[model samples]
Target: MNKAPLITKMLPRKNSLRNGGELDTKQLLAALMAFRRGDFSARLPEDWTGVAGKIADTFNDVIRTNQRMTQELGRIVRVVGKEGRITQRAALSDVSESWGDAIGCINVLIEDLLRPTSEMARVIGAVAKGNLSETMASEIEGQPLKGEFLRTAKTVN
Candidate 1:
């Protein structure tokens, strides 16, 4: 029996399959869902890699801003002003509120940065855990929790 060609019989591919540029939301969402299920390289748009770094940088900035605000609030709390520190306390509270807002901003930025990569990394890392060699595991276990990885040791002698 002469059947229609196999290619003709097959269903049409999605838009991403036909197009050759940035993946749309559906594709990204599918990839994210796939990432949740198992390991898969979450392909990013060429511009995405750059954008991720920027988001991380912004997150860092927010953290720094929070720290600075906290320190400034502490200083304000210590000040001996003629208004009996009420004004200073109020100002410090405002700064603390601002710090809270900054933290929220950082949360949003982190979510943006993590959109797909976090899931991808989680899936990949989980897969890696299952496939780790004893030697690699030993190396990781043995590696000093110091040097570049330890923030507390920033001023190591």
Candidate 2:
């Protein structure tokens, strides 16, 4: 009367570590290839017990961390570079290792980029206010102006 159980019992066990049902490795290979193609959204199953499972866990962790960093970087760049909101900084507070170094360098670079702009604004603003005595330094933070920036600084000063 009921053939459901009979048909189900006819199939082989799947790789429980991944799909947990079908033993076919096509899914695994496809997921791996997707990861190789710059897709970090797919995560391998962590159900395996041996070395493979451990490797999968490490891979997922790395992907998660890198994804977060990349997202934060995109947000920071959009806000600061595209929107002209230079005060915005990367919100990754608990970062460490090379990631931390990268974030720190980017923040420092923002400040450096702002310095000349701020100096110009101050000089120009003072001039607009009729003070007529505002002058821009030849260099900011020991870095001399060059090319167009130097020319603009001279003109503004």
Candidate 3:
């Protein structure tokens, strides 16, 4: 079996490479390989028109969105780690719609974690002023605080 025929059939014609309207397969392959190696900066030439241009644009958009998400997540981790609480909520304006659930979950986690701590601080402050009857404001009927937080509130009370 002559492998030359099979190899020739798999490759684009030489004329196709020089065609001004066609995508440069070599460049596209390099960009894709770079992306696969975790280099999000790789991008196909935007000058290529038609579907090729659209595909490149879409890939670039995905890379940019992913980079933004990674940076934002790092910022969140640093803020929470250094300050011991989430100071600012993650910005959702530029984030993709697929991340909406994750953003909402993070916000909820921040609120849940801080709410009990804030209530404890307030109760402790009130007690420190000789008002021993003070208790956590979160000790309501339907929205009772949970587990360790409830026990903390009881101890403070």
Which candidate's lDDT is highest? Answer: 2
Could you tell which candidate, 1 or 2, scores higher by lDDT? 2
User: TM-score, each model?
Assistant: 0.24, 0.71, 0.64
> Which candidate number would show the highest TM-score if scored against the true structure?
2
Ranking the candidates on lDDT from highest down gives 2, 3, 1
Off by over 4 Å in 3: 1-38, 84-87, 137-142
Model 1 agreement with the true structure over 1-157: per-residue lDDT tens digits = 5557775555234422232332354645665565555433444343433434343344444444545665654564465233333323322233456566664564454443333333334445665788432221211234433333233222221
Worst 10 residues of 1 by lDDT: 132-141
lDDT of each: 0.42, 0.78, 0.74
After superposition, candidate 2 runs with Cα above 4 Å error: 1-33
Model 2 TM-score, all chains together? 0.71
Please give, for residues 40-81, the per-residue lDDT of candidate 2 as tens digits: 796778775554566567777777877888899899889999
Q: Which stretches of candidate 1 lie over 4 Å from their true place?
A: 1-49, 80-86, 89-157
Shift in Å, residue 30, candidate 2? 4.6
TM-score winner between candidates 1 and 3: 3
Candidate 3 clashing pairs, residues 3+ apart or interchain = none
